[model samples]
Target: MIDLKACPLWLYRLLPFLRWWPNVTAHTFKADSVAALTGALIVLPQAVAFATIAGLPPEYGLYAAMVPAVVAALWGSSWHLVSGPTTAISIVVFAAISPLAEPGSPQFVTLVLTLTFLAGAIQLAMGLARLGGLVNFISHTVIIGFTAGAAILIAASQIKNFFGLDMPRGAHFHEVLIHFGSHLTDIQPWVATVGAATLAAGILARRYLPKLPYMIVAMVVGSVTAAVLNARLGQEATGILTVGALAASFPPLSMPDFSLTAIKQTIFPATIIAVLALTEAVAIARSVATRSDQRIDSNQEFVGQGLSNLAGSFFSGYASSGSFNRSGVNYASGAKTPLAAAMSALFLLLIVLLVAPLAAYLPVPSMAAILFIVAWSLIDFHHIGEIVKRHKRERVVLALTFVGTLVDLEKGIFLGILVSLLFYLYRTSQPSIRELVPDPAELRNPRRKFVAKTPDTATCPQMPILRVEGSIFFGAVEHVQRHFRNVDEADPDKKNLLITARAIGFIDLAGAEMLAKESNRRRKLGGNLYLVGVQPDFCEMLRRSGQVDTVGEDQIFRHKGEALQAIYPRLDNEICRRCTARIFDECHVALPDGTPRAVADQREAEAALARLHAQGATAS
Candidate 1:
């Protein structure tokens, strides 16, 4: 046998499952099988509900849970993330493709397959390009808002079946509300009763039973309730509908339409799905990894998700992603490795084959109720409340994303990301520039600690020290320059500026040029700009940009005390003669010109008395 440890890095990357294959002993296998069974049972009702949300036949959802789930588990980096149909992806798929073709039609399925294939291609390309960190751009607030919006959409889409009203398919959120409002008189009592019964059963099961799968319980309850109602009042009296029997078979091979028109139609939506899927998958993977104490390779997860979708499209599965619920369940059920996720697909197939015929007894209204419960679970109310209460910018992003999603599902996330990025740029463009003074309490300390300058604090009139607490980049050049100009413009005597550069995170080319120019400008004003605690990266940037000479290499210091000692001897002696601030230790002994400060102290006392007399004269 080939020694796996001797394998090349590329081989491991190409087949990630090989890395974990060695861990599958009898104990792990047993644990994984148990977790797999639990995950499969939990996914049964969810997969069908998600497929219904995607406007695909119920079997397509089960198909998605099979092949894609196995493929993702094998290829992905996460040991616990279970890939399958999810609420957000399902809603997005329906919103995107329903407008292009009739929901649940042959043409619609074809378009969706094409969309899946294209999305997989994009994700694969991104993985190969190592752009896994691209998902970092999508802020958590955006996800919360978008998920909340999609949840509401899911409930709105189910209104027709829940209340037994005739509404147009794929109606926008507002339109759904309006249609529901106008058709209140047309509600069928028996159908509404079944939906309500199922909803109540789901809520009660979820709250009380806690251990059982609530969706399955609710479905059984609704199906039995509908059957009893139909038998009692005859089928003609009650307008309740059944989901009909699902096809019981392994996922069959399929082909996506590769026509130019199909490709053109799906390309843009495919890109959107690719990004959304990657973000969802990676976020879920990392979240699960945190608890599992596993290191997740985001690029590998991207490749896994891509390959799953690619494989899924050929196996009659639509777009799929990491399911938060299923992944959480898998982990909580004590899954040991990726094998658990793969085995779940097999367990699901066996479960589906047994239960496929029973689906004919499942009521449509019950499916709607199950979806309502799923949707309700999707809204993160605690996080939403925290965002609203804690941060104004996050609240704005949440509101805009939620509202925009209600308006247009596909573009809403993009809009939220754009707004959040703009806010981020605005913040980074104005770095904190605070004047600092030596701490009076730490005056004798050799380290020379500093504090922010307060109104009562006295400063050296000729030189002011400031601390910059953010990156100095092209976007912030104008703001930094303005601060530099304001220093001397407000008081021409304050011509010299010393910056504590330890807090500066970065300095780009534009920032380096700006610093060089500011240094020159200060020198022309009979003063100079100095920096202390300059970081190595900033120093390297200065050297690379050829601005070190202009900035005066000697002006850069390693310590605050050293900088102050060096700068003290460069101050104006004439100004120092009458100044009483005496903030520095050197001021106690001698002036910048090395003259004894005793004479300067006598002059300062006389100057103070003269200033008091002048103030009295002005008052008189």
Candidate 2:
């Protein structure tokens, strides 16, 4: 553990804001300036589009991208994770908040801002409490599946604007497609023409023109087409729809709702949003870190995202989070540090003041075209293929989550996580226990592999051995009991079983009980259970559970020689007297019962069996 107080300047060094201050040099400034300018240009259209998705005032999305981003960059850990209104979170917020009030009502905005504040508080508390490790419970496959489903939803939602088909508000993906298909005859030619023109220009610009922003290119193309259609054949005759007007002013200060009833209603949704946002932000940061080779502190990320939303709630912004496209673009555009994220917000503020009026001219079809691109990039086909091929169990989790997100966005991720853990537990319930017979070729050295396929020749006359591997836990109790029963019930001559426990990974309370009960059961059958090479922790657990007393310390041995020496005396004297095989080195010595190795006749009987085992490669 690091003692932060040991270093005088530890507090200052650990803070992300302080660390980035020194990197604000001329070169960094120039790189960040270009990146920031580019980010501002990209965010303008996306914010409005995302706002439309969230069912909020068009300006609210812009507000979310501005102040919250700067706060998150300054307070959070990652140098390149730019927080803003994201597609998945937008859809969730709309799905969550739209039903309670009018989509863009004053009351609805207050409730959303309030939800943001509460979510921020929850996240901040978890971070300060060092619950960052909780994110691991949500697997990466779940996120991938959820995002893919969300992308499809994004496309489905825009089908109305995409082809001038009237889709029901907040329609399910299936319903959207069904409605669009049913209303195919009602498609407006001029609207379809504008939407298609935007799609073509965006696709073409992205494919051929590497320098210009595709959003701008697509918007211009779509708007110009809409304009020509409108002027040539009047707005009524052609039905060339447009996004009427938007206030071009800066984000105004807004207050969050603090009523008990409002808090009660939004709290559950806020928590869900918090989990999704943190997972999205952290996952994006880690992905970017892999490309840039930078380390990310998840705890700090939680705090940063929390503070961002907290600031957002007071700044007229709704709940927002990391955008994969913006973050990836920031990294690809040569961002030197987190300052680039902060600078994007600063530059966006300036851009808003100058060209916010230009947004009224931006057609809705054009915005949908840009979001279609955003949705397309979220699918990770390569990783999806690898997961499907390499792991069969994960495929179910991936498929369920991917399908469920379209059904219900808020609960899909949770369902996936739940299923993944169930599969893990099922896989771990039965540990591996293999019947081990000694190799005849390794008689002299004894340090050789046990041949599970080979039949035992009962070289020792009485002892049986098996190797136990993996953890002994509550659910694995039955599997282990069956293994013990198999060994003991194999042959009446093979009455004693010695377990080679060096491979046993861990032991819990239930494991200790099974061993104790098995030991007593074998004792009733005139046989004994002995443990060899038991780990110290396993022993401690047994002792704490009072199972060591029941099994007895004398029955547990630290080494093979010691175990064999201890059990030699307990072997049936009649069998040993008639035995030919004295396979162990300890068998040459006096047994623990003080019985010496058989005289002339006894040696002949044991040696006869030993020779037979040597020829057959077997020992029981």
Q: Identify the leading candidate in terms of TM-score.
A: 1
- Model 2 over residues 569-600: C-alpha lDDT tens digits? 78887776665566665555544356665454
Off by over 4 Å in 2: 1-38, 244-246, 385-391, 435-469, 491-506, 526-536, 551-620
Q: Rate the local accuracy (lDDT) of all candidates.
A: 0.93, 0.82
lDDT tens digits, residue span 432-463, model 1:
99999888777767788989999999998999
Model 1 residue 462 lDDT score: 94
Instruction: Give the C-alpha miss distance for residue 151 in model 2, angstroms.
Output: 1.8
Query: What lDDT would candidate 2 get against the real structure?
Result: 0.82
- The TM-score between candidate 2 and the true structure equals 0.84
